[model samples]
Target: MTERRQSVQQSPADWVARQAELYEESGGTEGTTMRGAPCLLMDYRGRRTGDWRRTVLIFGRDGEDYLVVASNGGADNHPLWYLNLESDPRVRLRVLTERFDARAETLGHEEKQRVWPHLVEVFPPYADYQRGTSRDIPVVRLRRV
Candidate 1:
């Protein structure tokens, strides 16, 4: 049997590390909620290093797909995970205790427009994040592979 690789923690924030630990150690059961909303763990290969990196993100459901925002708290650029996914769309997602393979797709303007409201409803701060930055935030849909 092939050995499983441990995920590398890339975020400098203490909470991120802590949250990831709590979420992962519990098989995504304990720390499944973030900011009072459901969260999922996304694992992707780093764009440059090619190492496995994971992050916990709040998500909204789009039928069978999951919706995630690249707001980076309204920063001028996209989040690292989003950028990594851009380089490689293949990823693994953990929702609660279940794990699955998925493919990430950046939504175009028209599709983003159609899905934006549902996202905003799920996480109200998304609207505020958009207003805080001039750059258009991207909303990615993670479809099951």
Candidate 2:
């Protein structure tokens, strides 16, 4: 985590509360954070709206790096955070108390299948969620910048 990334700020008290619950509890092992995966309140300014959007995301480790997904739990609509990143490209991400400068990039199909299983190890519900919808879930790489 860099000081530059840490400097980005967020709002919405309820969003903050959920973030605390998700990260502190260790991906829902202790309690729930939205979809039962451990979550980190990702704070970013919308590309179009410019309002800060705090999104809760499921994460998995790819070696030392963190990976995120735009599964939306197989929702019909793409997650708002995905659109926000697509519009802006640059981002600030947090995992528990740490913050990092990041850029989200979509992964290839084969890569997604490989990485998603690791995510399932962390939070198993994702495998089941994939079956619920028709859209292809996007797996994102959260590279440290």
Candidate 3:
């Protein structure tokens, strides 16, 4: 007999969790954007709990790869999602209706600088998020596995 599977847990933030639910329930057709910015759903394992977790993040394209900012709304600390991915680079992402396995890499200073402008263009508020924080926001590159 097969055991019952647990559902992926969403972020603790109420709005974020709701958005993730809408995206998944509608098969990526609904809740595709967040505050007018295109976003994606990311699934990864909890660093400590070892449970599947999900969150929504705005993405920018870098060639064939995807880029996401670990701004954490300009907070000094890195976002929990970023830390989880750092612990385990493996991730499952949904961009619109397409879902795929991918690996996450936090870009180095030079690499992030090269793509910074493009990313800002994709989501203008990222520039403000950086200006508001003393810590340099990390830019993570997601490559298909």
When summed lDDT is taken over every stretch of 10 residues in candidate 2, the lowest stretch is 1-10
User: lDDT values of the candidates?
Assistant: 0.87, 0.68, 0.91
Instruction: Show the colliding residue pairs in model 2.
Output: 27-38
* Reference-based lDDT, residue 89, model 1: 91
Ten-residue region with minimum lDDT total, candidate 3 = 1-10
lDDT tens per residue, model 3, 1-145: 0223287898999999999999999999999998788999999889999888999999999989999999998898999999999899988899999988899999999999999998888889889989998999999999998
In order of appearance, the predictions have TM-scores of 0.93, 0.74, 0.94
For 45-140, candidate 1 gives per-residue lDDT tens digits of: 888988888888889988999999998988998888999999999888889999888999999999999999999988899999999999999999
* Clash number for each model: 0, 1, 0
The ten-residue window of minimal lDDT in model 1 covers 1-10
Where model 1 places Cα greater than 4 Å from the true spot, the runs are 1-6
What tens digits encode model 2's per-residue C-alpha lDDT throughout 3-31?
Answer: 23323334345765555555544643432
lDDT of 2 at 80: 75
Off by over 4 Å in 3: 1-5
Q: Which model is ahead, 1 or 3, in terms of TM-score? A: 3
In order of lDDT, best first, we have 3, 1, 2
